[model samples]
Target: MAISDIKRYTHLTDTDVEALSAELAGIRRAVTTSLGAADAAYIRRTIAFQRLLDVAARLTIYSTRSLAGQLLGATALGVAKSVENMEIGHNISHGQWDWMNDPEIHSRNWEWDMAGPSSQWRYSHNYRHHVFSNVVGMDEDLGYGVLRVTRDQPWRPEHLLQPVRNLLLAATFEWGIALHDLHAEQDRTGTTAEKSALSRALIRKLARQVSKDYLLFPALSGRRWRRTLTANLTANLLRNLWAYVVIFCGHFPDGAEKFTRAELENETPAEWYLRQMLGAANFRAGPVMAFLSGNLCYQIEHHLFPDLPSNRYARISTQIQALCEKYNLPYTTGSLARQYLLTLRTIHKLALPDRFLRATSNDAPETASEQKVRAIHETRGTDGRTPRRRHRTRKAKRQVPHGV
Candidate 1:
């Protein structure tokens, strides 16, 4: 089912589609050419600032006993950790700065400050999630298989508790991501050897993180071991929660669209761009918030150009929004607070079955008599048209189990 078959955005013609694709390509080419010294300096400076903040926070927490010191240190450390995770780690892993040819900042060489291994994250996130966007079955980021986010997903009794599950998931988002990378939810169905391998890999990655944050840092604090431990825990939790919120706001907001597999069949490149636009939401924020959220505040642009430098999103966003308006497409966006609230609402709404809600198909209606006439005409290949009925094989005609 192509975009044309759906008739959801009937205003766009083939010429308009081509024009849109060409315009986007022009933006990409222009941006690529513009990437130079300034972009490299921005990434380097950010990394340096993040590291300095982390060190200062740790030093303060380890040396002082005052409540003010503890609060300041913990908050600073949390900000540093969140910045590293979102701005430095996430963008570097996306190869956004790789055009600079800096080995240190390259996706292949960078390791994120998270529980999930960089290699595993690239495969699951940069490749799978970016490629599929909000496609229901293909994009694992859609609820991460722990919650039902959209009405298109089949509802089960287990989903009834997702609202409660969401809090815990957000609090421990880094660990959840690690397990998600391993497909831990499907461990029961995996072969023993495969499960064992995945478990070992996850444990090894987790051990490295735990050793640094919990053991090594705390032990090095001398008399303030307990304080340091608490600070590290607090920092990790804050980063996790912030990342979870920002990500949820970008992905599952009220207007973010989700697509069924049927809608993706034989999708064209221009239609693929349309899917990314429809499936991502943006939030209004200042420069500081943009930096903290890794410029995922412009998530619609990010989804469309995942490997483009984060700084470029803001500059390009106005043009992208204008293009959407010209195409008469929905450009889902709002203030951060509104978007976050909408995400929470979506999660809570889909957590339980909505008996009154029903799934709608994109296919157009045809009367039985009209259908019979069309079928007969199609069988005869009349009016120079291919017969829809004769093209499908008997095996292809049989329905498979839903979602399989």
Candidate 2:
């Protein structure tokens, strides 16, 4: 029941979609050209701040005996990990700062502070996930190979535990992602040598991460080894939970649509742009809240311009919203708590089969297609025939280049 003809679904003509595409491209061009010393300075300052906070938190955890001090230290450390994993690592590996040409900050060279290899995650996230967005059966990120996020994805008995698995995933989000990527890597590597190399890379990453947090930090604490170990565990757990929340808020919330592969048939940049708009939700965020969420609260903008700098998303959002208004399209967003609740609702609701559900597959909150929207204005007279709206049915010209 996922959307197929995006044009018909939105009731936009070919001309309108094309004009919208041009306007969006203009926004990208303006942002791309404006990237300069300020952008570079922002990223550099963020990296420095993250590093300093991390060290200070670790030291506090090692030396301080007060419960309040331990809580503060663990929380600060968790924030550092979140910033590193989401803002810096996620953006950098998206090639956001590649124009800087700084090897230390380049996508190809910057390893992240998570269990997963940044290289593997880059390929999986940037290419597979971003490109596919919310396409059913294509975007593996939908429910993350666990929960049934939409009706299009068939229900299973195992899904009954999705709510429970959701909690477990939140607590160990990094490990879940790492395992997901590792599975993909294992499947792709045909030869024994290739598999061995992939396994070794993952092991090295795991050893580096675990030893840093568990062994090295605790040992360095000496007399306070127990305190340091507990602090590190707490920090990692908090970071994982925050990451999971931010990601789910942007993705599985209501109005973040799912699509059929049929939508991709002769898809235009305009359609892809529209899909990104319709397929990702945003949550309200102020400056601090935005930064902590890695500016992913502006997830619609991020999907629209994935390679653009994260700091610029707020500005891009205003433009995007204006464009949405101009086109009479729904700009899906809500408070952070609201978005997450909607996501949780979908997860729990979809755990059961369709028999228990009342809404039609095409009109459900978590799953809808062209027919749902069309039915809204479909008035049938005494003749028992519905009035038709003036809309384009055929696909648009595939003039835009397919993004990788």
Best-performing candidate as measured by TM-score: 2
lDDT of 2 at 183: 65
lDDT string for model 2 (1-404, tens) is 89898878776789989999999999999999999999999999999999999999988887787999999999999999999999999999999999999999999999999999998887678877899889998888888898899999998899999999999999999999998887666766789998788879999999999999999989988888999999999999999999999999999987788899999889988899999988888889899999999999999999999999999999999999888766756677888888899899999999999999999797687776777765654542223432222321211110111100
Candidate 1 ranges with C-alpha deviation above 4 Å: 1-7, 184-195, 356-404
How many residue pairs clash in model 2?
0
Candidate 2: list runs displaced more than 4 Å: 379-404
TM-score of each: 0.85, 0.93
Candidate 1 lands at a TM-score of: 0.85
Q: How much is 287 displaced in model 1, in angstroms?
A: 0.3
Residue-level lDDT tens digits of model 1 in 234-305: 999999999998999888876566666765788788878777876788888899999999899999899999
RMSD of each predicted structure: 9.5, 5.6
